[model samples]
Target: MSYQSIHIQIKEMIFSKDVSIVEFQFWLAEVETFLCQQQNFVLVVRSVAGTTFPQEYRQIQANWYKKNKANFFKYCVGLVRIALDQVDQERLNTPALHVAWQVPYYVTLDRADALQWAVQRWLLCNA
Candidate 1:
């Protein structure tokens, strides 16, 4: 499934470029729908190079996670982010973001490493 800058394939979601608030909201809605399905799944987010979002995006995402904390903890096995650089990775791995994530969160500059970690987490959670 593809929506604007967001693309979903199997258990992974890729953000190929910057997105508008409308696109961000739509992606959040998709995430909410996915969580509602009550299936254990690893969420891998790939942020391609040069992709960035406004501060409003963070606030909106944090709010969404706060509202869905219970369902996230119940269904999301782990969260893996494939960042473009160390700065991007660090930004996502901060304490404030951790509070919203709650689940095991891993951030890396390597897409292969991110997918490997996500798959391991998913298998472990299911096992």
Candidate 2:
């Protein structure tokens, strides 16, 4: 699947809302350049919001993320403030560890905190 390139200025870490796998793929294609060129990254998902992806699809993507864990150095995660169903929370919580349970990483339930944490960490990483 192909998606129109989404342009986002990530000079400072910021929270991104739910995006599809193809859009995620497109975003990653963009992020790879940053990861290779910059210090680190912190990406946040506000919530599932909506999706056409099946459960298996998300699981597969999450699995790929888990396998490529080492590809990340500067990354963190934040969940949305909106309420989520049990299944959605489970899905988010599981892959979130790819961000949460790590060295020099953190998980914030609030978007503002997550962005602040990510920016601080990025500054520290560069310093």
Candidate 3:
């Protein structure tokens, strides 16, 4: 299936997809672009049940982040809102496990909870 990546005015980065390695790489670059421009924001990812990336894709991501970790550390705040369901515990943990970048990440079962958590984190930091 396809993916959707969108940047809202609130400075949150959101993406929903079931993509291949190549598509994931492209999507990640778009995320990097947003992080670079926004400088610091929360990320919201919506994933389907049973979705998992190949080990090779995970390796590629790890390598890319190893090269760009400093940039992410410099510009990003490191909070992730993952939207998934309890039925897919494995998929729910995939992002947190695969991410090479250092940041406080979280997973939620729904978009509303994810958004609320992200916003609360934002408010806590800004306050």
- Top model by TM-score, which number? 1
Against the true structure, candidate 2 has what lDDT?
Answer: 0.48
Ten residues in a row with the worst lDDT in model 2? 75-84
Scored against the true structure, residue 35 in model 1 reaches a CA lDDT of 82
The sequence of per-residue lDDT tens digits that candidate 2 reaches over residues 1-127 is 6876533323332224544567656544554565565435555444434534434555756665575556654442211222245555455455565445454544445556656765565555545
* Candidate 1: tens digits of C-alpha lDDT, residues 1-127: 5654522223677775777788788878877876887677778888667777766998998889889889989888788887778888888888886766788888888878988898788777666
TM-score per model over all chains: 0.77, 0.51, 0.65
| Residue pairs in candidate 2 whose N, alpha carbon or C atoms collide under 3 angstroms | 41-74
The deviation in Å at residue 82 for candidate 2 is 8.8
Estimate, for each residue in 1-110, the C-alpha lDDT of model 3 and write its tens digit.
49965433223444344457877788678668855675555666665555666558868887878877777675555455455556554555665564644666676666
Predict model 3's lDDT versus the native. Answer: 0.62
| Model 1 weakest 10-residue run by lDDT | 1-10
Count the clashes in each prediction. 0, 1, 0
- Stretches of candidate 2 off by over 4 Å are 1-20, 51-56, 59-68, 74-103
